[model samples]
Target: MPSLVAPLMSAGCLAGAPQPSLPVEGGLLLRPWRLADAAAVVRVFQDPDIQRWHLKRADTEAEAREWITRWQQGWQDEVAAHWTVVDADSDAVLGRVSLQSIILMGGQAEISYWTAPWARGAGVCSRAVTAVAGWALSEAGFHRLELGHSVVNPASCRVAVKAGFTQEGIRHNALLHTDGWHDMHLHACVR
Candidate 1:
């Protein structure tokens, strides 16, 4: 039953490496989420666009802290890796980027992201995604990275393209949002 190639990436590849702070364009940095950012997280989840796409909301700072806690623990579990994108000078929260559905066995993971209202139109999401994907593919030893967004979200498609991911195809009814199911455009980059 075990007829297959060896793991494309070693087990514990992520757990063995500490999460790192990454730099992005426009003086932004991607760092591990902290509990102190609970308030900002709540603020972002309030945005209707985010709620629609991300399909979740943080109505309270306590809930936001729990989310942050999960992101922290995910590093050890090697299931997900989330980062808060912030301004390098003032450390203002600008957005988020994450590697989800991590499969060390395949040396691959999916990328996710969002931009704060204030940071929209400033390319924060694209830049952060690029930085994170670059690190995941090169330093983190992942062979491939994927980015998927609702086909309805053209802006997200733009972010993926700008981040150097190529559009591979679309999946019908692949994403479940709060409203209903949505088709998703799939994008990918290989190291």
Candidate 2:
């Protein structure tokens, strides 16, 4: 064997390196965002519900391509790690989960998640959150995970609670939602 290292690297696998895929239950996998996912990404942003909560405007086709490009740049910048929640059986995109504002000095990370409107109530966000939190705590070496949601959004608060986060406190006008600035409930989990 003339050192298969080069071939392995080119193929995107190597011993002692991080595995690319994150396996979840029910045949779903959370993985890196792909440029080819622009269509689905646009669909997500086009959703009025997602737009309301995420505080984003509907994206045009050109803007959707730019969105995917930004996603790639985000990973490249170490500013955030974003994942696409995919169905294990059909490989359909179920949602998104991410760790943003990763702070090594404070050993903390901010967690965010969203599921397709159709995937609501199926525990998809919860599962995806658990996986991401585990990765941040263990693999990413984060000691604390923080989550925040507008107090008006009880569904999101419930998701955070279900993911083992402790309700910290309300931050007045913490978030500027589509409606306006709103009180946000902060949650944190220490590993």
Candidate 3:
């Protein structure tokens, strides 16, 4: 039997158009990843803090290329969208921001990000999140966007709040990192 609810967004609403490069406050812009970014990708993943926050690491240029392939495929499949946050003037990557687990029919997605070691403590991640959230809510037509972070990471909590996502609650043992399972603080914003 079919459910009574209507989907908030159309299936092709996102994939129908090319992904956009968003220029936010600060000197950052969110642009699609390229294979040429392989070296930078590997370098960023080598950071201990990045590895701790995001389990996987790209050790080689080939591995970074594969990651880029997946990100591009995700956009075509309309399942997710990944953007490399870069210096708008120089086009050098400062970090990355992504809309993961996108459900276009439901008008919802989850946001994730990591900053390059050099960009840390300079508010790059928060600025990227703010840019992506604004686009997802206003232009892309998503009804809600969620940001989840391990409760142990206060920095992510600060980023989420600074990006305007309200803390909803915690999910018990929601994420499994290399250390062990962790409770996640769930934050969200609705259009």
Misplaced by over 4 Å in model 1 are: 1-3
Best by lDDT: 3
TM-score of each: 0.96, 0.85, 0.97
Instruction: Indicate whether candidate 2 or candidate 3 has the larger lDDT.
Output: 3
Question: Per-residue lDDT for 64-90 in model 2, tens only?
Answer: 668667765655665566788999878
TM-score of candidate 2 versus the correct structure, residues matched by position: 0.85
Q: Order of all candidates by TM-score, from best down to worst?
A: 3, 1, 2
RMSD of 1: 1.2
Model 3 agreement with the true structure over 114-163: per-residue lDDT tens digits = 88999899899999999999998998889999999999999999999999
**Which segments of model 3 are wrong by more than 4 Å?**
1-3
Report model 1's TM-score to 2 decimal places: 0.96
RMSD (Å) of each candidate, 1 decimal: 1.2, 7.9, 1.0
Give the higher-TM-score candidate: 1 or 3: 3
Instruction: Using lDDT, rank the candidates from best to worst.
Output: 3, 1, 2
Full-model lDDT, candidate 1: 0.92
Model 2 per-residue lDDT at 10: 22
Better of 1 and 2 by TM-score: 1
